[model samples]
Target chain A: MSSGDHTAHVHRDDYGSRMGMWLFLFTELILFGGLFLIYAVYRFMYPTEFHVAAMELDTVFGAVNTIILLTSSLTIAMSITALQRNRKTLSLVLQFATILLAISFMVNKYFEWGAKFGYGLYPGSEMLLDKPSGEILFFGLYYTMTGLHGLHVLIGIVFIGIIMYQVWIGRVHSTNYVRLESAGLYWHLVDIIWIFLFPLFYLII
Target chain B: MANGTLYMPETEPNYLDYRGRFKGILGWILSTDHKRIGLLYLYSMGLFLTVGIFFGFMMRLELIAPGKVIIEPQTYNSFFTLHGIIMIFLFIIPGLPAVFGNFFLPILIGAKDVAFPRINLLSWWLFAIGGGLAITSVFLPGGPADTGWTFYVPYSIRSTTNVLPAAFAAFILGFSSILTGINFVTTIHRLRAPGMDWFKMPLFIWSLYATAWIQVLATPIIGITLLLVAVERLFGIGLFDPALGGDPVLFQHLFWIYSHPAVYIMILPAMGVISEIIPVFARRTIFGYSFIAFSSLAIAFFGSLVWAHHMFTAGMSDTGRFVFSLLTFLVAIPSAIKVFNWIATLYKGSIQLAPPMLYALGFIFLFSIGGLTGLMQGALSINIHIHDTSFIVGHFHYVMFGGTGFGIFAALHYWLPKMYGRMYNEKRAKVGFWVLITGFNLLYFPMLVMGWLGMPRRYYDYLPEFHVYHFISTIGSWILITGLLIMAVNLILGVRRGAKATDNPWGGETLEWRIQTPPTHENFHEIPVITGGPYEYKINENGQEEKKYEEVT
Candidate 1:
């Protein structure tokens, strides 16, 4: 019922904004769902090869990254709570903590992927091309799925960094924190995707 | 306007004339107003439509005599491929919803604008960039994609043409569709007028509600799948390339998964437009309002299950084909319900054969032909027989072009006055309708016959036995383009200088007609409170139906 002006007086609907974020998150899930379907089909087709390839993935690295993502999700959630309590400094600290965890997760992924690349085990690599077709496909899905998931982690870090600044400026605070809350929702989605990716790629065997 | 300050007019101005921070072209493009955004889609779609039709016309001319009249076979391949890409992605997919839905969804529901105005503006920008990339692929080094719009893998991965840009364009467009869907769903859920409830909302809103859900849920699948094609191409990933231990059939499954429901995304909004038009012109309250509303949901829900029907001829298990065939038939029930309701609404009413009503009736006839032919293809045996034939092409054109395209034309005729505050010439509009419908059937009907006679589609040249059909279809293309040109010119002239129109030119009983012509910057001066159905036309003591305005603003 407000005027359709862009900036004179903002029309804020917290519930509507949250609902839109959830709907967007659903689309993100479906986006990853396509890749998951591919993973399932390939896994079913080349069971032995997938098992052999899963054995190649370092479980310790996957487990550590999983813990990192889960903790980042918690810190983002707590940041929302801190903002709700009007503790701006605490909220910013928590957001920065989440961003640090996200960066650490990406760093661990870098060393893991770097180890695989050192073995020439990437899509279209000469060493991979010499392997069995099923094994090649296993590495292909590995890179595509985990690689896409890594991109999401990087995006989450950038998003939280922006929201952290917004909170510092008092634009998003106790009374109006949907912006921070939406960033948390996106960050959680990134974490949940990694949770599924962890078992499917690293622990399936 | 001062820097960093919006220029809010002292008195409310029509959205078309509203001055904002930006001026001229910048104003139209940068403005977050829903009305201006709708016009932006309309104008961009107009440009794409002309280019797409030209491609179709050239393909038709090349087929007129047989062995390559105008271009080489490779060029012909790019022509149909580009034609399908432009028409499907740029024209029909966003056709009705982007143009009419953006303009009217908020107004029809008695709201100021969509839930997220900036996101809505972003959707249009994505559409433009996606479309630009697609057309720009034509002049790129490798030329436009010849993998067809579906971009079926193996060949798609191996093709030397610019499949990358085209595939990326569709992926970008999918994002735009998803954003629009999110915006509409949020707006409808949160921004309805004070008293308008679920059932009392306009049937068009119901159709959009269904269509928006499909857009949100279905488009992301295509987004990822197309990206997979790009990945497979760039990295030689073994996703769909058979040489790399990939199954090509999987690509078909994933492609149609989104695309099959995408048909609903295109038509459901068109159905909404028809629902709005039929009752207004027939001068009666819509019969079976809930049925029409629910049928839209039914179509959206059932449409997703029937993607395998497209894969039947592509080779799947018998049980899989059987299940998908059955689901395909189930989806038709809702469409039939809508067709029957439109017919019943026409019966025993003061029917005016206005230009919009004419297009509505045309949609019923043409879409029935299209839908019935679809069922014909849904049969396992019949589908294999006509799977890649010209019959499939005919069936698609009948539905996408005849049904949804006509529905868009009807919307233009019905709502353009409200949009531009001017009226198009009625006699010329009726003439345009007749010519277009006549040319339309002439262009497509022969494809059904030729296809039944075993003429395959996507062939550069056909046998001499198919010559007559191709000739007639080509002639029909000429007439159809002429009809299109006539209508385009008439509408353009009308927008420029037609007579000023009254607010409620068609006596529409919806919330839109209750407002000012070419509505103000905020659609309603005061947000309305609705107390009755969208098409509540009461009968007077003189035994004629009269609309009673029960809505309070």
Candidate 2:
């Protein structure tokens, strides 16, 4: 009870906050789940087209971005640990590191999307790619999924920036770490989503 | 103290003091106080309800003639769409929970405030903003969305109306619902008094708990689905447009995913109200308390999976239809359990025919018919006969309006004295109830017959053979509207000059009734540690019911 209250007074009930965040994550999973179900049905119907389209994605770029996201997840986890131990400076540093890695992931994605756009692979673009019928379907899902993921990453960066400011101002301390934990949890989720995206769009044979 | 009336001098800043009346008004409008925020929701929602009822009246008037008499076809289409959107999103979903649940949940659970007061206020503001956007869309150049509230895809995408703004408004409203759910979940879990265990909490809190779960879990799907619709309209995204190789059925899947659980989100709190009213008026413990609580949860859980039943006639596969029909039938079992428990609770108890109790009885009888008719729709064979007819509309009205709407009125009447510190005229209340009930049946009952006779819904005109039923329904609508107006006036008068109410007006054992009417800012002067279950009806040595509270100090 003491530990619960101690955690609760500063963090305002981690059990509730954590449960709420998990519920949110569940909703996120279901949102993407709808898209995933669509991807499954479409891929099953047009296996050959999906494979040809998957081959167009740069695996090297996808693997590098995956590593970047995975490392950012580590940095975020370490930052949570730092905040819990009252190491404000160390936590701030780690958060910056995580943010930098996230930026690197986005930068790599930018060039890859640029290359696709240059090849006329963009949806509704004048650059007509091979196999018009199924290629449009492939690219449609591609842009929607990655574009939505990019938007999430942007939101995650903003969340981390807010936490960084709170730490800098000394508003967050060892007693108050729930926000940090929740932010870290969100950052890791963004990374995990990218992990699946890599395999589905880049690594699949 | 013994009489439970603690009056301070009128000279001082009493509980009713509007001293910072200007600031108080602004404070209520803008401040993050949960109570004030709750009242803000009440006023805003009431405004929307008035607008929605006017639209409904127009719809009824338009139906009075077989052809377009009152309004043109396009205007009629938009009118009914606006009516559906406002009544469902603005009134019914947030009706009881936002106004009543926000005001009373904390007090009933012995807490000073909801866990996240600022977020609570944010939810109300979001609702206001969303509602404003919806209303603004009505004046758009293309006119308001006539795609119906469901906004089924192929037609929705092809329609040249203001689908983007209307759908975006719905999307924004979903966030308000989600935030409120998060706030309530945290408050109920963290802020209960020392001895108020999960099972020991009032049934209202229990209903809210179930409702919050649905809001949290289900609202986001609609949020994203509506956003997809907006995106589709804006960029011609092929998510639901079949001409662009997108599947329209996917839209149905996503829409129903949220809209189905949304029905539970609307009704579960009302069920909580019925549970509270029954035990109090019947002078007994609620029969099968755990069963009732679990049934609310069961309804929430099963409600999500049965949404595909709405898509049966929309060209789903034979397998998909069969599975959804089976799941739909499964969902009814939990609702049946609740009805059975309500009946069992009334068994072997002294039943008082209070206004609230009468509404509860009305709810049971009507919801039973609603639920049973729903099972008929669940049958693929029967559905093909009655799909999209007035039967579907009549069935939902029985559940939503007859079940949830009547239940909300019951709760308002039951709690008004405790909330406003005044008693309404009992005689007038009974009269209003009977008129509303009779009119409600008269209005909707004919629709069931007309539907069976194959009268389609959402049409501006119908055949002459359907005229008698439509005429009856129109008259019934007039009667229903008048009854509602009378009830509203009665409550207003009651608030002004009625008798000052005692705390335990219904003689219930809930913690909310233990406090003075219009409770203090902190709710409890001192927090109570619960000593017994919520529906404790046992008599003490004097052969009278024991008072639950020991002492204030």
Best by DockQ: 1
> Residues B1-553, candidate 1, lDDT per residue (tens digit)?
0011122334667888878778899888887888999999999999999999989999999999978699998898999999999999999999988999999999888888899999999999999999999999999998889988889988899899999999999999999999999999999999998888899889999999999999999899999999999998887877878887888998898999999999999899999999999988888889889999999999999998999888887779888998999999999999999999988998887888888899899999999999999989988889888989999999999999999999999999999988988888878988988899899999999999999889999999999999999999999998888888888888988888888876777877788877767788777766777778888765322555333222322
Name the TM-score of candidate 1: 0.97
- Candidate 1 has an lDDT of 0.89
Position B215, candidate 2: lDDT: 91
Q: Which residue runs of candidate 2 sit more than 4 Å off their true CA positions?
A: A1-11, A126-133, B1-22, B538-553
Best by TM-score: 1
- Colliding residue pairs in candidate 1: none
Name every residue pair that clashes in candidate 2.
none
Reference contacts preserved by each model: 0.66, 0.22
Superposed Cα RMSD, model 2 = 4.2
